[model samples]
Target: MNLAIALTAARYGAATANYTEVQRLLKGPDTGRVCGVRCRDVLTGKEFDVRAKCVINATGPFTDSVRKMDDQEVPNICQPSAGVHIVMPGYYSPDNMGLLDPATSDGRVIFFLPWEKMTIAGTTDSPTDVTSHPIPTEEDINFILSEVRNYLGPDVEVRRGDVLAAWSGIRPLVTNPDSKDTQSLSRNHVVTISDSGLVTIAGGKWTTYRAMARDTIDAAVREHNLQAGSCRTMGLQLEGAQDWSPTLYIRLVQDYGLESEVAQHLASTYGDKAFEVAKIAQVTGKRWPIVGKRLVSEFPYIEAEVVYGVREYARTAVDVISRRTRLAFLNVQAADEALPRIVDIMGKELSWCEQKKKEELETAKTFLYYEMGYKVKTDQLTDRSEISLVPSDIERYKKRFRMFDKDKKGFITILDVQRVLQSVSVQMDENTLHEILNEVDLNKNGQVELNEFLQLMSAIQKGRVSGSRLAVLMKRAEENLRRQAIPVDRSGGGL
Candidate 1:
């Protein structure tokens, strides 16, 4: 959806500076006229001034902040409300189904729906101070879980441990000076032209974005009597909308040697441009299996997407993981496990040095920990030190790999792999074990090395293992473990 918005802006010849911040508004000699803006690039720390016939202040929840820049005495028109959402395992909702509660116990709306193969339940509308990144509170998480359980069947349960990731967003609910709560405030968008000729648009939802933009642009045109054509976006196709189909993944599979899961992911994500991404994988220096390897073994996200995202203006690892792909949103653990490899690929693609790579990884981890509510163990480093990316599963896999390494070598044989599975109480059949060994033992050797074991196990920990019988058994086993009723961790950070 964000990509479509960006593409639509580009379609109209809009030159955007994504990370640029407005330091102040440029004013004309005459009072009550904004002529331009002085902006600073957040990423490069470069400052520049842009002169314009008219300036528009559409900063959403920060509308008042920008308005204050024009005139400090202006009253606040925006009442920002924070709405929190949490992602869980898919079983909470039916396949391709959604549940909406128009009025919850608190008389607020909440939705439990399937998104990106995971169940997303949200949201609680409450007054909040405006901020760029709002962390989801424990009370908000509990409220959602409790409300969702009220709507679910008796057989279905909403467990806190099932939450994969959670986030909070500020709703720019606009209104007068009266102290009405956000829920009581109407979400009707308002376009106001200040005395300084600054146009501010606020108080709209996703479904009303187009109307808000159209109205804002119409106001801009009328305010300056700017010559313009009528809006043509009503029939315009967004970027990647052309030449796309549900079956496009088939071509990727046939032409690029991509796994069906990976192909489908690419086709769904990039639309017609899936072919372009696949072409990169086809010609890259990496070998066949490695080139097409999944970032997280259980998920269909592949390394190629990282390079593709970087080229598409994904300046950070968090951008690639959270926005470009839904990995970080779907499963924080899986996203954490895949971080190093993603950073490595992105570093090479963006030409980042070792220090820059370290910075990127740390920044990504900080986002995951604070913004996404994933906890990290900050402690002393051992031979197996725990970084933000090294979740318990990785450490567990290392221990298991070492335990099964009969000769104390860095590698383990197929038999040892079977023993490790058995130790986990996962009873995979002989055929499935051999298939797993065949997939990860890239050299076609009869043994599975420690690194190969970690990759295989990490993939198995979360979701499906395509083209392998282990998918069903592993899924069932994981579900059973999940049903054991682990105590909920209510402190900051996640379960």
Candidate 2:
């Protein structure tokens, strides 16, 4: 139904509409009822107006803001709850199926589901203040890991260093008049038309978005006496939903009902028409094994999927794996193994240069590092190997660094520094190198000269760097190398 609405809106050329930061709701209009929505495009700074007989505020946990727009006396309407998940290597468990832990250390239900090949275990319930971009703090991770370890065994260590990625999503649960615990708040939605006629839809999960939309629309239809037709969503199919096999199609149908096929496609690709993806994954002369499944092509399927994601779905590279596909949580190896192919395909499809491909790869890596809480092994170029360095190699490190200084400028970029560090069996923080240079660059010219670079590297290598001092040095080094006109010897890093 969500996809159906999106397709319908798209077919009608519904320009992308999002609330610019809401200015004060206009006063004394329509007998003090909310008359018009005033918003500015955060991107272009363009202001716009939308007049409605009834306005639906389905802004999730932030519904209270809409109440303020209505009359400022609506009271708090939502309680924020957080969900966190941790991604571990695929080989951690014997079975590919997911494991559900009914109890967590924090007394929440935890799910250890099989996501792709990787095992994704999560979730804690905690109250929080509403915010645009909410992040899971260190405490959240420790809590999740403690619970997960209880079930998986103490051997399942989740060090801050081991986390490839971690994320926190907010549940905009409806405030319960009788409930004491926020977790006890209803997952069901509430449709209330304020005195100002603003219809706010609060509370619900992804699985129940359709029902919420239907209820919200139905209320609007009756309240405004609009000429909109009866709900056709019950039978509508999403794009690309018709071609799947009966079993797969049935499963989709069960999940999405009348919009089964479309929902299947949309659920997989986030509402984009994925015909090109099917074409790319069609049985070819070559077949490659993926998580034991013999795929027609090794990774072109993933490559095509990524291409479709970026071009058709307005996805950033991070969005491609994090949301579009379960790659971030699935076989972490799969994503690492497919990176080259994905980048190559994206380069061809989007007409990107080598530099653009590198940038995208870097962005993807960053997302993996920080957003996904993935502890990417710097020593290994690919994620397929589970091996870690048993003994550090100081000589291999010096040689790698020597080679990475491509221009013989004596100064290395953060990429170079990262490569060398990884070669030496060291895993520096993602932002460490960049931060180091900032502190070491005494002239503030932004470039870390040979001496400054070496001094900073020595500090990091010697284990003397910490906190902001390390971050500044590392950051400055990366900045200096990235902006330098000189190019480094790519092959010296022992690729």
Candidate 3:
């Protein structure tokens, strides 16, 4: 829903993330008609001026950051709260159904929504300082996993390896501007015009995106006395949603020669304009990325979606994978395979230089690894500590990894990581989890499948792994056994 609104705004000539509003324009000293902003091309680092009757700062958690552009001393009105989500396999919830846990063990709301062939279970709320990138903590991960496990069926035991992805976002909570108690703060959205003639909008979720935009623009126009058009968004259908219907799903499959599941995925995501995207597959002879049965597909996203994202959307790798098609959120392994390809497709579409392509990859890497909280399991690493020198230790961790291979597929998955660690009694901080996982993931597949996890276990035991270096994971298994008051003799040895 939010994506459609953003795309619609872009259609009406709203320059996007490519240009940062550097400074504000002033007519006189104080009571002046607030003008447009000074835009700097992020790609080229070039600055230029533009005009607007009223400037609106709609940057959610970073509301103050942009407001500070107009006045450095501007105080933050938005109180940031960190929320983390865990993505589980689709089987956790039926494809057509979703699960919402109204409250968690911590007295907070958490939801397990069915999205992108995976169950997106989240949202841990903890008051946090505003940050551009929010990483999930070990306690955060453990809490979510433990809480989610409480709701899952008896047959379904979640493991860290079963978690395809983990992500955190900052909620732009409107504070009392005076008090700390949330009750004292207003639940309603606040649209305020700063002293420098900058209009600010904050404190809302997906449910409130439209109203937020409307209110912000309405306030801006009225305050500056600018003759702007009425909110057309009420009747303005997104590019893809126009004339959309369920029957179109079947028609799309028949017309485009696409699989049923593929058509359904497209129709639902892109709406009526799905045909436009589906057509690309036929023209390019691109293959539909079907992983297993028709129901269980890996890379449901196609080259067509990649091209559409670059051509129509922000044209960045992160936008393509993370937002446009949700490949990054859906499955990490598929996204890892598709990232280079998406970058290549975008590179060709955008006429990017070699250097530009490198820059895009670097930025996207930050989003995938750091922001999204997936440890990049790449082969290139200078960390010798992460290198395993012992076959026995590697074998031992492999056995433990099998426990997380809940489906017994010889591979570990998303929900497995923290679960197995904690079960073994190894717990570390959030930053440490990020560091260790990134280097330990040899394949950078996010999940520890095949021999990759075995390699990491051996490295940790050798006391070489940096983040995993802190509390030698070797203690987890032993500690758990001791806490249970059971003796675990190393001589007898256990997996």
| Top-scoring candidate (lDDT) | 1
Descending-TM-score candidate ranking: 1, 3, 2
Name model 2 segments beyond 4 Å from true: 1-5, 8-15, 18-28, 93-97, 153-162, 176-184, 246-272, 278-301, 313-315, 328-369, 374-393, 400-495
RMSD of each: 11.7, 12.8, 9.2
lDDT digits (tens) for residues 88-190 of candidate 2: 6556555656677775554688877655445667787888888765666767777776766666666444444344457778898786434555445777888
lDDT of candidate 1 over 1-495, digit per residue (tens): 777678667877988777789999999886658999999999999999999987888888999999999989988888899999999877777887798889899999999898877889999999999888799987898899899888868966455656788889999988744445533566888888887799888788888777777888888989988888655556667777788998988888787778888888888878888888887773435555434767878898878788888887789998988998888788886888899999999989889999999999999898898888675532233322112224666677788888777556456877777787667655555755655555555433355666667656654554345555546655654554457643332231222
Q: What TM-score should be assigned to candidate 2?
A: 0.61
Estimate the overall C-alpha local distance difference test score of candidate 1: 0.77
Global lDDT scores for all candidate models: 0.77, 0.57, 0.68
- Rank order (by lDDT, best first): 1, 3, 2
- TM-score for predicted model 3 compared with the true structure: 0.72
Write candidate 3's Cα lDDT for 94-199 as tens digits. 8887767775676888887787667888888888988766888767877888888888778665666667778888888886444556464444678877766778
Candidate 3 Cα misplacement greater than 4 A, ranges: 1-3, 10-19, 23-33, 71-74, 153-155, 176-183, 228-230, 282-297, 353-359, 376-495
Q: Clashes per prediction?
A: 1, 35, 22
User: In terms of TM-score, which candidate is stronger, 1 or 2?
Assistant: 1
Report the poorest 10 consecutive residues by lDDT, candidate 3.
288-297
Q: Looking at candidate 2, what is the lDDT of residue 221?
A: 86
